[model samples]
Target chain A: MKPETKTTSFDLAFYDRMAAVLNAWKHLGEIPLDKIPPHGMMEEITRLLYLESRLIDQRRLREWLDLFAADGAYWIPADVDYRDPRRTIAWEFNDRRRLEERVERLETGQAYSQIPPTRTVHLLSNIEGMLADDGLLHVLCNFHIPAQRGQDHQARSGWCGYIFRKENKHWKIVLKRVNLFDADQPQSNLSFTL
Target chain B: MTTYSDHLPSLDHQPYQHLFKPGFVHRRLYIDEDIFQQELLYLYGRTWLYIAHESEIANPNDFITRRVGGRPLIISRHATGSIHAFFNRCTHRGAIVCREPRGNTKGFICGYHAWTFNITGECTSVPLRQGYGKSFNLAQASLQPVARLESYRGFIFASYSKDVPSLTEHLGAAARLIDQWLDRGEKEPVVVQNGAMPFLVNANWKTIYDNAGDGYHPPFSHESMLKVFSNRYGDVDMNYYGSDFDKSPMYSKNLGNGHTFLDQRPEMHKLSAWKRQHVMPGYEVMENALIEKYGEAHALPMLDASTGSGMNLNIFPNLLIIGNQIQMPEPLAANKTLLTWFATSREGVPEEINAIRMRMQEDFPSFGEVDDSANFEACQEGMASIPEMAWIDIRRHQDTKVGALDPADQLWREPMSSDLHMRTYWQRWQELMNAGATRALVEAGVA
Candidate 1:
């Protein structure tokens, strides 16, 4: 039988509606480093970073979501050099809405990859922070997470870069990008937040 | 009674052939080292293994290093505009000539001895050549190329044996479906995007291949993903496979020469692909731009192109095209497999459309593949641990005579959730494996 290519006017409306809802993903590393944050400001930013890691480890996802600004994003690039989300694929690229969906899925207890749940201990180090001219604080830190699931224990080592913005007397993450050392290599199933 | 063992002492085809029954296969096929080695020689060595896409090395002198069938290869586009595949090993002292994974370069210089070879695998320069005898010829020192290389519709494939059937003959009826997929490009070239999402699964390559066309697993395996799709977006196009998915009209076909596909077009045609998707980052503005430029009629199909072609096409041994992604499962070992999903985009489409395509492509590998990998690992563990359960029963729909054959193409259509696809491939596998190493894959006029 011959394959047919049929077109309909109603099908056209779907594209229009979908395009209207789709947003362009931004590269988190686009901020320019102009100056260093004050010593106290760095300490405060470090405290917030520590709190974020702790929240994830404790499985307090809802609380962790609160640490992000309304327009925050969580990104894990497929490669360290891949800065353009438009052309490159990412392991995880979540906007606030997507992040909320991810949290909801995990909480449903049906996300089979995390059925028994992955127990993780994130160790953060080499923390440094700088302030952009626009009052955005960019922080860079090395991280090593020892995650265990069932009979398997995997040690994931990576460095994280974060952009923080202060809103109404609170520090919130605008973007968090994780760059694994073996970013381009074939990775095992990474279902949990890194 | 034949026994399946982890430490099988022989590689003889006679004893292993006894392990495959009519409706079941021995579990040792997934865990035994000797059988795995034999498979490498008999199946992968004889089949047309996918190597690289034409878009990957679109420009001359561009190259990528890949390990197909456990053999390290350098697929490069020569200055002469012809593509070439050669062993990645150096002619001198056996060191890897090119260390980098992929890049465009004039020539590759071996770090050990500074011996250089051009992109086309020609030995251009050799340091301290005078010290060697004049009998040592530069022409003879060129890298070794594979026995055969061929591509169809921008998909490149290579084989270490020249005795196999022609690529067109091997593709058989599957070519029509691949063309059906390519037609979405609207005559524009379908470009494989740069970044690849490759994940390691602790399972046999065939374990993943078996699941590729099995419509029975998705509702259970990807229940979470389906649930999220339903809760967030009402009635997504591809997410309709719920408890009653078996009753759906989708058909799984066994294309000849071990090729198979799970056709989701029946459901996909019910709705435009774009209308069924979860909302993306910047929808409104892009929608208006697309509608204004292409007009409503043209924009709809373009949106459909952004999602999958609604067909999960699996070419024998490797190569799977599902959604907007191209997957190739490279078997590292009997129990270790590395699956790489290459996201694809249309050449002439708008950046926003391709960008949205990229995001939608990540949905499966990140969410759905996680569960699939977990199951693969679990299946491997179970097979390795349970020696008593010697056979894996693949007998579903065995008695159902509800199949139609397209005599022109020799295509066989079966129920979506039937085991016919697996059985057909296994029957082909037994034919190849039992044929031993010396016989031609297709004799005289049989192909």
Candidate 2:
């Protein structure tokens, strides 16, 4: 029997809509306490982000994948001003399906670039609530990850904007956008997750 | 203060000539800083380096900053739409004039002395004009322009030496290929995508250049991508390394003037057609839209030609138009190189067509580039560790081969895996380096 696989239809309209949604969330700023989720819910959301970072740092990619919604996307804009990924190049613009494939490839020992995978310490700070409407919560934070591969060490710092939604009573990532400080500058190997 | 020539290797033509054979290159060429410096002066200094695409500075008073041959330059367009390239340094204090990567302004004002220059690189005003005597000429005070600047089909290139061949002569047969790729049956001109993706690789710039037309490494270096492609498509046979892959028709060509390219139209067209028919998301919608707008005859051929034209065309020195990406490499040091990828799109093409192009860019940095980077870093590390092993082989199909030749263009085409393309690059490098060294010797009264 052939192995079962999951696929998402390539819909330009769907992608366009998602881009609009992401643009809105990316521009969202700190919201008033009344407009955001309850204080306890806000803390839980921050905890989930910390857990996600820990999972990635531990190289538990599968567990990290579990934190994202089925339709979630991870994007890193090539432009600091955030040009549409469909019209321009991006450091990464992976949909849920593509993300799964990336995780699967990393799991395979044959992925040459990751043979001696880099070890990373992800430090998350400046967490702030942006918006909570339409059953989605937008949050923003700053991250500094120091990664070491062989004898080389690189410090990657970026601002992350995430849109979270509740799925089965657990906060799941619906969208994640990272804007690297040096996105326009030349970069060395970013083989591991940021 | 040591001059640049003082740092050049003492060895002359004889030693440099011995460094390259028909199918071998000396390891010193990759690791030696002296050779690297010489290359910066001889090879890069004389070549018609790609500086920017005209579309990037289409509007009046628009400018973009870039580094050419280790020197920062600003490419600017004036109100009349005339484009000019100038040294980014100010004349007074030599401070960088254009600090931003890209912007639009009527004129540039040097932060140090408030020296102002118009978009055409004419010195418009000086903060202390009265302080200078008649000896100070404002006409000569403008930012120093590059020796020569030219454009072909909106692609801009600049050379440091006025004595160098005209841009047309320099491009030669490579010009035809670029025109074919850029035109692509589109009425409107091709423009660069909004932004460029820049990334660094820990390897010699030549290593990256050599890989541009390399066909042997993909099957091995990008094995994971092929695997992922298979997993995602559920039809492994359509992958680049599929069992049904026909190797005979696909070939690499050594276009003169240090340009080399891989021609895989038959294979690429077949893959593109297959994807459009079976795999590509929204393929049917795109096809319908194109057919309705352009009619069946025009739309079908355009689609086929677009798919077939995706190839690796490296215009020697720094520019590489590989598939949909216009890539350029800047050599920072002997072991450090920065590569920038600019996505190109036809101005009037369907949005879906450009969407697919953007998707193709993801295939690289995510999978192919990292793999290539590993190999590049490994090659550099290995060559540095062992000075005893001096030669790297490029002799795969050197001795025995039946290859096609295009006499009019002076191009020789051979199987994809052949070393013809790499051999062509080294030959051009040797010729240019020897010429530069000879010129230097004559100028120094040593010849």
Candidate 3:
């Protein structure tokens, strides 16, 4: 599905305030950490993406299961109004249990496609969004995962790989959608988690 | 007009005994430029190459632009509800007029001097009326068509040569290849829901084509896959990855036309019970439909979980299909070929069904086991650069019965089971290459 192509340019002051929150929120001196909410949240966001992207790109699969909460879900919608999960086709959807099972199978090394794991380097930028009605940060960010194995090099842009609501302080991935410009065409097999 | 011999070694001259004897194919078929060019004519050109589906370009002015066998062509839905395909290039300077891969255009406009054509390939607009003076005739300048364009249950294909047979006639034994997958949809237009094959390899294009038909490589190359499937299914022997399974390594190499269904045996379905327990509900309905059409016995056998069809299906030279309805598993290969996947359902099927299909695609096909295994083939960088030993052998099922269900049957399944398919492909290819430029494909299809 084509993602919301909003030109979300914020004011320079908005950038400054966010930067200040990010910087000041860090702790090094004193007895312990201070202003931990903002910095910790940023750290968590970066960590969450890096961690999830690692499992998917590395095909670490089993290790990947450790990251998701029991009730957590993975989604990649095929259409725009994907906000309502009931309406569209998502590339993947697994509750924690199913995800764990898949990972376990991957661990036993039954996965044929992963004899050589998928190598990936993700570039994340333009992070923005607000706290949703659910209290989880409604995070919106753009990431490009350029992956290669042996001689094949391909890129899966996250105009569609979405990271949805995260509840409480615990980072639970509510949704991850990937929309490729070439999504409507014929494809080879895609064994890894995007 | 380079005859196959004029170029280098000729197919007629090469002793074809290996093709008849050794079930294994020589690697030369993979790396040979001569074979690749010949296929562009003998196979890709003459065959009913899959071009586009009706769902993709539905309305007037709606068009899907793509390259067909080395030529720039556009498949468009005309205002009259008919679909047409024509060269996308302008007849004048030969510049491609339409830039977007797809769109609803108000008559395509060429940036080079603004030569314009309608969605029907009719020349619509040109610069100043006096530009070419009296010598020019606009009526004589309409866009040239592909000569023969036809659709089979919405599968659009075009042939450049006027002498070719009907699309159905060209399909021949090949029709079964399309039927295996298309039949799954119960005669509906097999909607390709945003599926894409995105990997590029350094090897010759035919290398990939022949590999698609090879049934032997999966166990040795994809033992990991077998291991993964075993783990997923709770089977511990891993013997399925070895030669212990009933069909052993040969069943996977058994699809006709150099296409094989590795797990097409009882051992394959015995392994799938675990998957049957895990799959979405829609699969049952789809499976039931297949059972009814193909018969309960044939259909049930396919569900053995071990019976997954090879969606990594080889559609002749350059196309592969994702086997069945759900289309999940893994990114078949991310780097070896350019992958694009469409999550298709009956155009009017419930939205939730589409969603489930989409989810499955992410977990498997577009990012599935097929892609990863294929990617490793590319990394064997060792496979390509070694001594002139470029010829990999497909002699595994050399005896026609080696690939056949019963050795008594005279008809061998060719490249998939016997070397007959490759030999046929190569020999027919030789005929076209020997004919040279007048053969249309070698002359016109080549840039």
Candidate 4:
């Protein structure tokens, strides 16, 4: 596919729109207590998360990138309560184009940091789901990932909040935010997708 | 308190003088525990060390706690708009006073003993005054301030020694360079956006410092970034260091003291071409406005230069001003270092420009920094294996007759790949370490 040369202006109004979208995700209001998704829908959400985790573990970055909507964003904030990506530093904030570039870099064997590719296994549990007012499924889960490079091993635990939209019987990720417990701590090289 | 030199292994003139030659530095300088301790003392203790940017603590009673030169410090801005740096430890029992990394508070109260102090380091109250004797002095119980504090363009620096040279004198020509860069924006101050992005590497602190001013490693070490740039910008020369080094208008400058920077002004223009091709959302509008305001000839170059393609400045010991980030390395141990990168933006610049700065910052830490870290760890591991090969050569440009007197002389110009900057860095290190030994002997009256 040919890459799009057109670029969107990141002006004040663009930031305002992003802020509203992020705020809406933050204050989803606990599934309304009575509006929780049925057990089958919860199971389906869990199955989708498991499939996504497997794709990341398998290092199928191109396939994983295809699972996201065109306007989807993958955000890993330095702060758990982070709202604005423009004003502060974040661990990972990638639009679709950035994500594609990242995959391209990884595919090139010249990416020195990933020359000896890191192997990761993601363990996810406590899956919860609700149908939000915007007709999107809000799924939350806790994950513990054990990644290894040569003899070095590291365990990272985080809470993943995802917004998935149903399109033609398939679920597409609209947003994914992972809040790690030690997000602010000094980390080693995080070259691969979390 | 005992002097820093007294506790370390003797660094007297004997074997110390042989450790470093003109272009070769001993490997032990990086791995020796005794030398590391001495550096924490004579070098870091006596120098003007960068602590925090003033913008981090802009409001009254705003404070950020940081470890500067292996000591915990609380840098606070008082209600009067004055900044103060104090030891984070309490006077009562030496427990940490503030636990939060950053916050705004009128005063700090010790959780252990309830010893309260205001933002100015004045002890405001102490629990149970009657328990102490009648001569108990509240005045003596105040938080201990650092010996001296000074700021240049909102970059705060503190020194443990009051008698050291003034901060401006210490900075010298480097200060002028920094001022020129900061003043390039509109008259408004440069703001450091967000807190730091901290990373830990299994390498000595000096390893990180050495890499900051290094130009030779980029072409080889960051092959991936080069490939990406090559593919994106079809005109980009992939041979960054081969034949391009001869044509590239880039050189390394030792800007007095131990500070040095790489002048890559011409190469920056080449990289800025990518911006024009894949322009940001409102680049055309901004470009047209700039052209109308300043005329086409001037505005075009101005826009190109605004991408920060001039220099990569490294102030010795800690601070590194590269691209749009201020990176500082804190030494934790002989083989452990904490690296923090802070994104900086001009306060009065267009929001889109700042957004572009943020996008540029993503190129590092993820790819470029990870590549450097791999080399740092590999260098440390290599030194461990070959302890007998004590000297590492930094003699690339040593024979060049580039005396420090003339700034305009072509003799002073060396390719960006030269090791002149590292040689100058080690020369300063040897001088300061030798000065410590000389001072010790003079105090003992043996000289």
lDDT of 1 by residue, B39-106 (tens): 88878877788999999999989999999988899999987889999999999999988888889988
Best by lDDT: 1
Please identify which of the two predictions, 1 or 3, would achieve the higher lDDT against the true structure.
1
How far is B353's C-alpha from truth in model 1 (Å)? 0.7
lDDT of 1: 0.79
Q: For each of the candidates, what fraction of the native contacts does it recover?
A: 0.59, 0.59, 0.26, 0.44
Between candidates 1 and 2, the lDDT winner? 1
Question: Which docking category, incorrect, acceptable, medium or high, applies to candidate 1?
Answer: acceptable
| Highest-TM-score candidate | 2
Chain B only, TM-score of each candidate: 0.91, 0.90, 0.72, 0.87
Instruction: Please report how far candidate 4 places residue B189 from its true position, in Å.
Output: 1.9
Residue B1 CA error for candidate 4 (Å)?
Answer: 30
Error of 3 at B296 (Å): 16
Alpha-carbon deviation at B304 in model 1, angstroms = 1.9
Interface RMSD of each: 7.9, 3.4, 11.6, 3.8
Number of clashing pairs, model 2?
2
Deviation in Å, model 4, residue B27 alpha carbon: 1.5
Off by over 4 Å in 1: A1-34, B1-15, B130-132, B283-285, B292-295, B406-410, B437-447
* Per-residue lDDT over A1-194 for candidate 2, one digit per residue giving the tens place of the 0 to 100 score: 12332434335775686677667755665566676667898799889988999999999999999898887878777777767766777777776767887887777676788879989999999887755567888788899999998878989998998888888999898888888888877878887998
